[model samples]
Target: MMHKPEFISPDWPAPANVKALQTTRAGGFSTGNYASLNLGDHVKDNPLHVAHNRQSLSPFLPTEPVWLQQVHGIRVIDASTSSCIETADASFSTRKEVVCVTMTADCLPVLLCDEAGSVVAAIHAGWRSLCDGVIEATVNAMPVEAAQLMAWLGPAIGPDAFEVGGEVRAQFIAQDAQAETAFRPQGDKWLGDLYTIARQRLNTLGIHQIYGGGRCTFNEPDTFFSFRRDGDTGRMATMIWLE
Candidate 1:
């Protein structure tokens, strides 16, 4: 029997009915680079392993998660109406037990929910989508006030590990001059802080209730599968839903 993954539940003060979980690279059937609980079937992991791994996660949720075919873009779908892997970076749900899920390796997985527990969402924020305003788009999509929404920033490539080119830095700085503060020059390239960038974006939108974001996929090899560190790697997931 396959064991369940080591899941990280958000510590944010979301209402009692709003449940969230972020899976680590543990407890599943995948082997080799996609070892253990690799949830992403698109990553060339064996379909049987992927299916069984996903199935293993079922007892933890109200329904099967609505996984996104993430393209690092800012497209959020309504979780209740979507079926089939939708081409989106984020998803929100109002209907009970409808899971909104995002798969990520080194990319940031942001989970959002209102204090009242009426809405929740999961966002896949890679550098491309992060710079493209995915966080802002998600905040705007939720029915609750931005102030009432609390976010949990999941594990990602930390500043010391995430090396970005000059162009990447320029794009963020172009959007907001203050974005320069989020980047520090490391030789010819720059060390980008996804968590800091996310906070700045969320703060600008008046969302101050943010938690999580210290874990690094690159540094913690045993706990996370970092795409930047491993070419053919598995992906963990961050999911949320209303009870």
Candidate 2:
């Protein structure tokens, strides 16, 4: 028998046919710090356990998601194709059931789809990727206009728990001065709001119909994985497909 992981479905204004879900850190065979359901093969979680966990998840998805080798940079791939462009930080699909996915521990996971439900994308938006324009790159790649799109943010480190250096804050501020407001001073460091930053990035691209924030990975030990909270932890997957 297999355990069905408890997951969250985004309640955005997406079209009735677009489907998306975010997995929690539950329902798997891994042990120790990974404890269960670690989807990221790049992590030190046992390969067999990760494989089993991924296989178990198949029943819940349109297809096995096109897992990416995220470099925290702005590279978006056409996941509907069978090409092996492995070094992308985001992926999109115009074809049905080609589940585009991104994995994260503390970095923000963002899913986007147009109102027509013709396209869907998953993004890995760490501070570095956010500042480097991953959101903009993804929106640019979509076939629809930005205003026709909706986005959903998944679990990540909250502002109260995500402390960053001055250099990190400066980089985002350099991109858009309004990014300055997303950071609060923490001595020489800053407390960054990953959700707010991601929202602001979407807003800049004209994607205002956003949803699914406020779930903090660092604070919610039972539900999420937080690299900032635990040095060795599992990764959660956020997936989207056009039905």
Give the TM-score of each candidate: 0.98, 0.97
Please give the lDDT score for candidate 1. 0.92
65-152 per-residue lDDT for model 1 (tens digits): 9988899999888989997999999999889999999999999999999888999999999999999989998888888889989999
Please, what is the whole-model Cα lDDT of each candidate in the order they appear? 0.92, 0.90
Off by over 4 Å in 2: none
Question: Can you write out model 2's per-residue Cα lDDT over 1-243, one digit (the tens) per residue?
Answer: 566777888878888889898989988888888968888898898999999889988888878888888999999999988466489999998999899999999999999998788999999998899899999999999888999998999889998999999999999999988888899998888999989988888998888899999988999999888898998999999999988
Alpha-carbon runs more than 4 Å astray in model 1: none
- Locate the minimum summed-lDDT window of 10 residues in model 2: 1-10
Root-mean-square deviation (CA) per prediction: 0.9, 1.2
**Candidate 2 clashes between residue pairs 3 or more apart in a chain or in different chains:** none
